[model samples]
Target chain A: MEWETVIGLETHAQLSTRSKIFSGASTAFGAAPNTQACAVDLALPGVLPVMNRGAVERALRFGLAVGATINARSVFARKNYFYPDLPKGYQISQYELPIVAGGSLRIVIGDREKIVHLTRAHLEEDAGKSLHEDFHGMSGIDLNRAGTPLLEIVSEPEMRSAEEAVAYAKALHALVRWIDICDGNMQEGSFRCDANVSVRPLGSDKLGTRCEIKNLNSFRFLERAIDFEVRRQIEVIEDGGHIVLETRLYDPDRDETRSMRSKEEAHDYRYFPDPDLPPLVVSEAWREAVRAALPELPAAMCERFINDYGVSEYDARLLISSRDFASYFEAAAQRLIELNPAQLGNEEEARRNYGLAIAKGMSGLLAAQLNRAELDIAHAPVSAAQFAVLHARMIQEVVTSKSAREILLALWESPQTDESAIDAIIEAKGLKQVGDADELGGIVDGVLAANARQVADYRSGKEKAFNSLVGQVMKATGGKANPKLVQEILKRKLEG
Target chain B: MIPYCADNFASIERMAISLVDVKRVAHLARLEIDPAEAEQACERLRGIFGLIEAMQAVPTDGVEPMAHAQEMALRLRADQVTEADGRELFQAIAPQVEDGLYLVPKVIE
Candidate 1:
């Protein structure tokens, strides 16, 4: 039976602020258990919670970035629950009215863009950590993270499959980092997701019963958990069993989502507005300031790459994976044309190929080198201008693609930040390619005479023999001959 | 039907609270209540619920829910870590502590 999988993600992105959401305690990770937990963080007597301007600003920034409506007034509510980590016995969160409402995020899956509508994004305070191991019949509570600011972005049940769900999660992950709101780190519990998964019969208007899979921080785990839950739901329905509306935990080791809640233990968090803090009022002027200060989003930048560089949509998407990579590509492409206005003149097509060449290099050998060296593009020894210099040499046909790799390896080992370093390396290694047909005619003719039988085999319409003939010419030229020019010259002489 | 009503005080269908509810709520609040305490708590809560139901019958749908006594916007503070380390001083009052962590009864999921 065909089943339509439905998934909506509730992502909790920890705002990258120095202080806790409502307290003056440090929100930094990796501290002693309670060193950062101050009196306000622990909800000590006579201490009231104060709102952080940085956290509210981040929420405003996110609302603007996703094109959401920033509510003029939002309120904080207290979610009452019992946990050792929750020092105050109530977590301050937004209940009815959230800071951001009604936004859309565009996710690209296999070159098709799907807009996942966001229900709302609210600001709240995070709970502490509970370490159960090594404590005899007790859980050790670390209140260091008790009051950190978290922006919970909820999406509508618009996704149809696990792949689309993962794509949406990744796009949201990149977005929070792109807009500089959250650190987007998954390991230290920075950006995490809770997926509400269900499956209904295809083309059904009514929704199916959903089970919330909680605390999936990794992308692969999100995909797997949703898939496992979907399969389990389908199997249950097929076996004459009804789907239980409950919360589940995804066990990555076993690759299954186990039901974590029983009907008797269902949560009924008696929520009420927090009386300590007043309503948060976002003024018009403040919203406009946050909007003006917003960075260039990925989708808009992808469109810019396509329009400005004349690159395809595929290449455009690849270039804007991260902010650093996108900026580096733009700088390098623009610098390439600036460094060589005459050689790579204002011919629209030639300038366009510069973007393509840089992208190709980045996607190919340069990517491998950087990955092997374990260096991010920001810390990559090869600067954008230096990369432009290498491509400036290539676009002029001074060095072939084969020798280009050798020069790139040298640059990787010992970065040369100067403009003339490329030329110095080329000159020192004598790696210039012979693109002039007249200069390479003697070498091609000598190779053809030395390998007459192979030439005859090529004239008899054997394609492999033609390749061997080209190989001999390349061997004679010590592999410095431009492969494209060599192929063009060989085809021309063989026809003549 | 409302997922989360802004005004929690605006609605209760003369909410009937039994001794079971009192005990459950007491457990949730981490309050130890005896049988007499539970009976007294139920009677008092019933009276409060009756008064709340009278307020619930009055339709104030358009009226804004007042979260605080004051209507002023929340005061925003700068995102600075102004608090110094007082973990030892604070933990001195805890019932149990191991390696600077607050210990509680074991909670398993």
Candidate 2:
């Protein structure tokens, strides 16, 4: 029997607030245990939580970015449960009322676009970390993370496959980083996901039992966990065994999920409106201020790249992966247009090709070099201005593709930032392409004279002999001659 | 819980806080109650529920329910890091700690 997977994600993104959500405690990571946990974070008697204005502002930024409804008034609720790491005994969160509601994200997986609907995003506090290793049969707790501000983004169960789920996760991750709300650092536990996965018969409307997979920090792990969980559920149902609803933990090393707790062991949570906090009210002016502060989102920037720059959708998407890359591309493109405004209008083909070349170089060559060194666009060794000059040189037929690759490597090693640096490199290394038609035609004539048999074979209408003549001309020029121009010269001298 | 029937006031008063219910509440709260004090606890609970029952009996069909008694907005604090490290001072009061971490019974990951 065919089965369809349904998945929802509950992600906790730690907001980049300077202080704890409801305390004056520092929210800096890697602090010593209990060092940053103040009286309020420690939940001492008589200490009340004061709402962090910065946390609310960051949440508003996210809501506006997603085009979600920012509630004018939302209430904090006390989610009561007992865990050793929870010093407050109850996590203060939004229950019935959330700050942002009913947003949707457009995600592109392969050639298909899917909309991942968001249920809500609410503000909450983080629990302390529990270190279960190296304690000699005892556990250690670090409360430095206690009360850190978090935005719990809950998504509807609209995703159908692991690939689509990963795409949604990536888009959400990029959006959070683009808006500067959260760092989206999975390794530091700044952003984490809990996937609720289940499988139903292909055409059935009835939902199947789901087990919540907890704390998938990385995208790869999120995909693997969902895949394993989906297969497990389908197999159990196919073998006439019903899946038990539970909370499960994904074991990455073992490549499977294990039940953390069965339904019988689940805690009630006992949610009730927090008595200490009043309704969190946002004025219309504040929402307007936040909306004004938001940067042009990735989706909008992507459309602009395609419409204005005339690049492929894939290229536009790649350019907008990070703000740094987008800004770099814009800077280089602006410089390119400024340098060749008159000539660009003369040849429509050249203008279109120049746009494509910029996108390709920015996304392909630049991306590969950055990935090889484990560096991001922010830390790129070559500045955008310097890269723009190099690209201009290539587009003007001053450097061949082979020499351009070599020049890029040399640029990485050098600290030269001026346009003259490129000229100096071309002069010093003698890597200039020979694009003069007269000079390349002479080289082609000499090659045809030396390879008489091959030239005769070409004159007899042998197509392969023409390529041989072009190769001979390139070899005779010591690979410095432009291959495209050489092939044009070879074709003209032979065929014409 | 089912709403109090208008005609079942006597039955409602009788079952407002039963001794068994009082014992169960105490157990769930992790508090041990002496057998002799069970009736006292039940009586006090019954009085509290009796007042609540009376309040519910009053017609509130059209009254708007409020989340809190006061209609005040929550105060917002600036998002600033103002606290300094005080690990030793905080850890001094802990029951057990080692290597700057609060020690507890072993927890499985």
Best by TM-score: 1
Q: RMSD for all candidates, in order, please.
A: 2.6, 3.8
* Candidate 1 TM-score, C-alpha based: 0.93
Task: Provide a comma-separated list of chain B TM-scores, one per candidate.
Answer: 0.74, 0.69
What is the lDDT for A59 in model 1?
Answer: 95
Q: What's each prediction's TM-score?
A: 0.93, 0.90
The candidates score, on chain A by TM-score, as follows: 0.93, 0.93
Name the weakest run of 10 consecutive residues (lDDT summed) in model 1 chain A: A341-350
lDDT of 1 by residue, B10-109 (tens): 3445347799988988887879999998999999998988877776778776676576778788999999989999998999999999999999999988
True contacts kept of each: 0.85, 0.69
The TM-score obtained by chain A of candidate 2 when compared with the true chain A: 0.93
List iRMS (one decimal) for every candidate. 2.4, 4.0
For model 1, state the Cα shift of residue A278 in Å: 0.7
DockQ of all candidate complexes:
0.65, 0.46
| Cα lDDT of model 1 by residue, A1-496, tens digit | 7899888899999999999999999988899789999998888899999999999999999999999999998989998888889888899999887899999999988968799999999999999999999988889999999999999999999999899989999999998998898999999999999999888999998899999999998999999999899999999999999998899999999999998985454477777778898899999999999899998889899988888778788778878888998999988888887776346556576568788778888878777888899988989888888888888888778887778888888888898778688888899998998888898988888887788898788888888998888888887877789888888888888889
Q: How many collisions per candidate?
A: 0, 0
> lDDT of each prediction vs. the true structure?
0.88, 0.85
Worst 10 residues of 1 chain B by lDDT: B1-10
